[model samples]
Target: MAHKKPGGAQWWIVAAFIGPAMLAILIVNVYPILYNFYMSLTNRNGPRRFPEGMYEVVGFDNYIRLLTQSEFYAVFGKTVLYAVICVFFFFVVGLSLALVLNHPAIKGKYFWRTLLILPWAVPTWITAMIWRFLFHGQFGPINQILRSLGLPAPNWLSDSFWAFVAITIVNIWMTFPFFMLILLGGLQAIPTDIYEAAEMDGASFWQGLFAITLPLLRPVALPAIILSLITTFQMFNTVWLMTRGGPRTLPGQPGATELLLIWAYNQGFAGQGQRFALVSAFAIVVFFFLLGLTLLYNRVTNVTKGAYE
Candidate 1:
């Protein structure tokens, strides 16, 4: 018999109610992650074709193949390039926006914040499509505006490098709002006394920012930056919808804009050779690579806790 305290009966009742939720986590979340781990060792397609069509364990062949393939390497490199570039731009733009908004003199804060974040609220696909039209060589508003201003408008979509830039522009627009909000939170949490104290010491505005405020803000903002990097590293949909990885990238290589996710999609759906095994291998490799990267970054940065302090 379960012993119940005088007023603790309700606690037990609540526990009984939550018992099923714990079970759901075990069944839904934990199980899928474990199942994926198991699947990573094999070369298998969708649900088994028959009872006997079990997964064939290919040892480390999937990983080996994924790491060794030139196409995979190229895609991997592009993924890193895209992630780094986008994060750099996002950090710079978002931090600048946060700094500006943190100023007491800035008016219409709520309105400006809502306007900035509207892009994030809009559906990604819609934003991507809109950007596609805006980058369209013949009739994009961008081109029209340039023409109206008496400036030459380059064909944005046709050029490989420019198309990649177009993809980054959309991603940056979608992401910067999130960064700004997080950084703004950090900025707001800062103690006003620190600035006042610095001013009393004859510190200049820039000195207060560099010597006092930045150090304090970094601790609060580091996690946001790390999360952004992880998400950017896995970015896909916008680039996929915008470029389709391109007109004719190479015989087998991914286009300039094709990151690892698109490369995996192409491989998984590659008509001539439907290599589900290979695709799984690539995904597994990417997963571990990102995992390793996060761990290493965390270790090196020593940003585990209270970095701002």
Candidate 2:
């Protein structure tokens, strides 16, 4: 007969199995957040290598500076606009392709799927670099083609409007595949019988889509959209690599394409004087903003409930 172990012994055994992972998480994730919060409350500046006493607590000064500065609002606005545009296009392109691929007449579905997903499969940094070359006004194939067609070849990276457009296009290209995959899976999981019934009722394609497909797709789509929004909001690699948040349109202001994370990164490392505490404060504010966006999404949509229902 197997003897039951003591409760304390079982607890210890469980802890032993999980202890190292927990410690690793604390060191990697928890420690950084705690340290960042600590830094936000101080006046830490200069390089990363510094003695503890070099900085002292400044309480809410950093946060006050971040909030009161008009530059913060401008950057925040641009970031929001970028995320909105990218996510909107992501859904539209993804849903359109998914619908087409789901059609009964479409052939070589796998090939099409692979082709569409290629952009997402490529490393993001590589995508950014490739697009940067593609947008070059003088030597880029895009401008060459435009010249051949007698069309204007605008300065893509140097003009603020065109720079924004270039980044938006790159972002859309890199991300739409993710939405397509998710939405395609969601569409496939839906029952054919539902559509057949709608057809029997003499519904047109658009009617069926609005009345049936879209409603059913919401449970999956909303969550994906919100997740995409959050990801796009924090996106740095593509924007930074391509534009470095440049094509500055205004004096004493943030760059046109300088999104939130890029701004935070620039504050810390991209300048002669590193403002570690200010950057930390900015990060904390961004963290809270994202947290609020998530909570608000859940509260408004009740996505978890809809998924089960």
lDDT of candidates 1 onward, in order:
0.78, 0.88
What clash count goes with each model? 1, 0
RMSD of each: 5.0, 4.1
Q: Which regions in candidate 1 have their CA more than 4 angstroms from the true location?
A: 1-55, 270-273, 293-309
Tens digits of per-residue lDDT for model 2 on 48-144?
A: 5345778888798999998999888988998899889999999999999999999989999999999999999999999999999999999998999
Clash count in backbone of candidate 1: 1
Pairs in clash, predicted candidate 1? 219-308
Best by lDDT: 2
Question: Predicted candidate 1: what Cα RMSD to the true structure?
Answer: 5.0
Worst 10 residues of 1 by lDDT: 45-54
